[model samples]
Target: MAEVEAADFETAIAECGFGLFNVFILISSVPCLTAMVFSAATLSYVMPSAECDLKLSLLDRGMLNAATYAGMIFSAIPWGFIADTMGRRVVLICGGWLDGFFVLCAAFSQDFLQLMVFKFIDGLIICGPFAVVVSYLAEFHGKKHRAYVMLFVGLSVSVGAMILPLMAYCLLPVHIFFNVGQLQFHTWQIFIAITSLPSLLSGFLHMFLPESPKFLMSQGNYNKALISLQRIYALNNRKSRDSYPVKKLTDATPDRSDVINNPNPRRSRQERYKLAKKKFCDGLMQLRPMCSSPFLGLSIQVYCLHFCQIMCVNSVRLWLPQIFATMHTFRIRGMNDTSMCAVMDHNTHGRPIDTKSMEEECDIHQDPDMYIDNIVVAAVGLAGFILIFPFLRIAIVANHILKVFLFLSTFLVGGLYFSKTTLTTLILSSIYLTMMGVCATTIISMSVVIFPTLMRTMVLLLIMTFGRLGSVVGNVLLPIFMQISCIAPFLWLCTLMTIAFTISLFLKVDVQQSLN
Candidate 1:
């Protein structure tokens, strides 16, 4: 028999046939991504109702809101290193379960301090799946389908956001309370437990999935990589493994120079310690290339764009419920002619004009408009994703689309500042946030195509670290800025979006071409 040719990694992946496995991977990712959104966003709904329960001041609310981002910022580097060194699947499964546990713990929190601690831990763990899943899902697809699959998963973020408000609307209104020993449980606590389910479910779903075949190949484990491909081929094509094509994968060199060369397992304790030390060193060394030469410039550009994009999107997103609540209060007070700034002034006054009269002011049940407005914003974002899905296939469309979205976001932020009525403010804020979110997902898709596999997760996590820092900064500064001048935060967001728009222009156009 003639000698068969060994196929390259991309060729082997393409031959796997995108069918059952691809859909499964995509479906699995929705919960992973949604869990991330839920973890970050749960506080937005919890804060308003839990205010009386938790004794939360405005500054306390801001700190609790920023706690997740603060934890994520600190943990990003460590998670990146672990994901790259171990495997993407390991990070996803372990992180998802731990995050869920912490979120559930948060539901049992007796006070603001306890909830803050739990939320921070939730942030610490959830960063793993949030950064690693992008690489994991993309590795399953060939170039032709990679971008489309990523965008579809990105849409799940909007889906998660939409689901949050609906869940809040349903659960926040119900009067549920119980006594668990010395602890008191309320409806908000149940709301939090329900939100944790997604992370737990995501971890459970990922238990059956295989490690990325590309990561295996990068580690020079060709046999295991081939086995993974065969499994995927078998599942995707509904065929026997024996009938799958591409029996061998080419011995492609690792893109990363520091691919760990595992030592023999029977080594002595002292030798094992040495090996562990060497592996740790190797992991640190892997980051050097990203900070130098060709990668350095690309890294800086993407990091900046990510920082600005996340800063604008998450700042507005995490606080949208509060913004809507303010709008709701304004409407109830018959201040229909007031701008968002005027509403902020009303909300900031430390004392109520008449305690009895203002008793129903911040109550979400009385003002379903807050939840409805948030649902509308999230739905519009979801719709934007659906509308843009068709254009994602076009060559280099991500770049142009990103630029256009950022540009529009700038104007939307400005328009939001000038918006005088509730209707106008909601409309402009929805479009602004939707645009910023789309830009964020577009940048993530671009990163998958632009960076090599070995460093992809590390680079992504680092990018996200800066992005989370931006979120932390925005969350912490927003209240301060609002107190100084309501228009100040809007102007600040506009400036950030404008800078991000300029940075988007510098991103390599070849990213889309690489996908093609």
Candidate 2:
């Protein structure tokens, strides 16, 4: 027999080059942008001036705020298992449109119960795509660039924040009204419809995009994986199949821990059944290590890190818009009452009011910069993404920079709490968003390094599940804390994050392996 050398599948991908194929993969992951839409919807959906305000109390309001995330925490594990089984594309397509349908249903909801129910179901399935998109995009890249690719995909959070408020500003102020069969349509309802469009389009877009080549290889569909690689090569090189370089992909180093091996080409039906059973058993066996001993402690540490990151970030984020709204209201209140609009006189008299008779209690004119402020904060996060995401390429600094950023975040919370003016608050919040960009990206990058392919997505989901749980707690408690004092929520956040920072110092991540 002749001796031969095999190239790593990752090496083969690098040979194909990073061009249109990489850009295509980037576009494919854009659906992840919709991940924050449900949370942002609450910013616009339940506004005070909104015609159909639920008129909810503090606790009720908190629950409504957390409802989508509550559904996500519940569904995370099950959805991950499904993505690992039924295939990522199917789950994304179905989940994406289903989320759109339910969110659309929420727009017409008559009561808090209806809105909450629809929003919950929307999050239940939508989280499948949100949790898997990073892993999916990472898998498509060569190991040298995988972590950075995932980081770019994670920018969807900032993109969502920028988008939601811009759309709301345009639609919310318009007092459109119409009726059909006891259902009423208004500017708010129209806003929900527009926002849900992404959820509707994401699935359809995936219809054209190929599955992760790494996923195909994992499933023992080597030929299919090769075809995927060839397609990417063709797209990147602007050449046909004949010009594609690679004849076949070879796993130079096969993963011993992976339960599902390349399938036997010549197996009987009974043998296939036996293989399936063995694979299932192997998966359960593989999980034992992560769920126990040294790995178990690490898993707990990672979960807490992610939880704190989300809690600190979202606790401030979900409330920031409302805070801005309130600040503008106070500014208006302090201004001259001469600027007020005339109240309709329908209740007191069946005639129009004189110009001098305008009520002093008329609604304040909303600040023009409010939506722009949301975009600015989100853009600040993007700037952080640009600055920190690339640094992962430097193995030595990746771990150290993240730790330094984490420590700074604790102090940043104090800055946010004591910010007296809206300008100061915005500047502090923008800085916080930048930290969130670095901090949250670090968590995902760490996940990629810590776990192998077999359990990578599953473990990522577990981290996200814990993170969403923290978000739920923050949403539930922030309102209550605000009742006591303006600074209480940030103070409590600072205390919680101090514990997170201490734990992170002890975290022993393999940053070199993560960057590959």
Candidate 3:
């Protein structure tokens, strides 16, 4: 192994140059991550419509969602290894291509089974970007600013969350366009394909972007890493200084053969510590030896976090629209069966006087304004992640207790049955929002921090896969309990969160400190 000496660095970044490149990279990657989240979250909206239009059974719908997760669960480990072995750029590019292809397939699917298969495959392939992007961004920046930079990643996904409903509303008309005779391609297919263009553009842009300097150093490409860094500085229009202030690698930069054949270096702690400071810049790309070790404790912690977090988030996200619809029945102003019928007719876009009206009538749904107000409860969940960030140094045991209490309280309170009164619905919906928002942000951020760099891809994909499974569970329960007591779905969500709360008590390591 060779060492990357400090004498090799060149402090060439021009004023305002580095900031622009960083922002450019962030802008490109944010949408890539955002699209990933948006597609997953919006699937619930698409599935039922596809099912009803295609006359698929409830079992078929459940299979579609489950199929998506099943593919994800199976593909993650290998894909992570690929990202580790081949490179993030290749995997990310392929991920974008696969995402575009399968989404188009799903939109064009003629039968329920076809849609199921395509979605499953898409889910598996799309995860490559999600897992790789974090590692990609983490390597470029200093450790001091990692958390704050990652916050942008979180906000990007939040933006995705906000826009997903609008996309859903816009594309819902795809079904209507199906009845037309002139168009060769259906509207849904066009919608899916259009959504994928950003990913395609990202893939091309990534080619021009410099490979992670640390990754090159990890592969014993010290000369290449030097060249790449110089190019980065050039692109940023920074002055081409003779050398950089930072050392490129510590713990010895392994040769290409050595890295490929041996990811884990059996080196002494003294040797590792010696390189720690010098290699700080390049260390971001170095995989912790334990990442591949069979007995690694961090791996287990991340797995549990991913599994539990996804289950809770997906369970709530899939149920939100229904929850709001349930609350709508309680509205008081100018409400009557006739008005409800008229509203349903407007929403459904139909003229069938009696039969169609009988099948699906509205609750004289109030202004969609109420939807935003009631859903504020979920904001508490989102807030919890941000609030807990500064205090994350506390022991996991203490954090575990608060997390459990937060979820259990929300579940129990939100699950309680009450008259369909407008006020009661408003209050309960708020609780539902809080529980879900907090659970999602906390787990997602925690997952990124906990997983070892090498296995990040695997852990994230597994988390998302489980989350999709949760959505399937919710969707499946929807039709069964749709006719039963109105409170059944709420009870199911409460139980799922309670189970997650119990699971959190067993974990110990905080991922945020894994690198530290």
lDDT of each: 0.82, 0.68, 0.54
Which candidate would rank higher by TM-score, 1 or 3?
1
Lowest lDDT sum, 10 consecutive residues, model 3, at 7-16
A best-first ranking of the candidates according to their lDDT comes to 1, 2, 3
Q: Model 3, range 1-516, lDDT digits (tens) per residue?
A: 122355321121211135556777787787677657645654554543443346544446456545666666667766776776567778777787767677777767666677678877777777778767877776565544455556656656655655555555565444344533543444445555566665666666677667665555555666656666666554555545334333343325454644444545887888778655545434334445445564256455545544554554554455444344433443333443323223223223332246454223231222344345323433443454456455544456324643665456545544445423444544554555444454554555566666654445556665665665555555565546544545564566566666666666665635345331
TM-score of each: 0.95, 0.85, 0.71
> How close to the true structure is residue 21 of candidate 2, measured as C-alpha lDDT?
73
Q: Give the alpha carbon lDDT tens digit for every residue of 36-59 in model 2.
A: 454434533345344224545455
User: What value of lDDT does candidate 1 attain over all alpha carbons?
Assistant: 0.82
Per-residue CA lDDT of candidate 1, range 422-514, in tens? 789789888887777778888888888777777889988988888989988888888888889878988999899889999988876555544
Please give the RMSD of candidate 3 to the true structure.
Answer: 8.8
Residue-pair clash count for candidate 2: 0
Best by lDDT: 1
Model 2 — TM-score against the truth?
0.85
lDDT of 2: 0.68
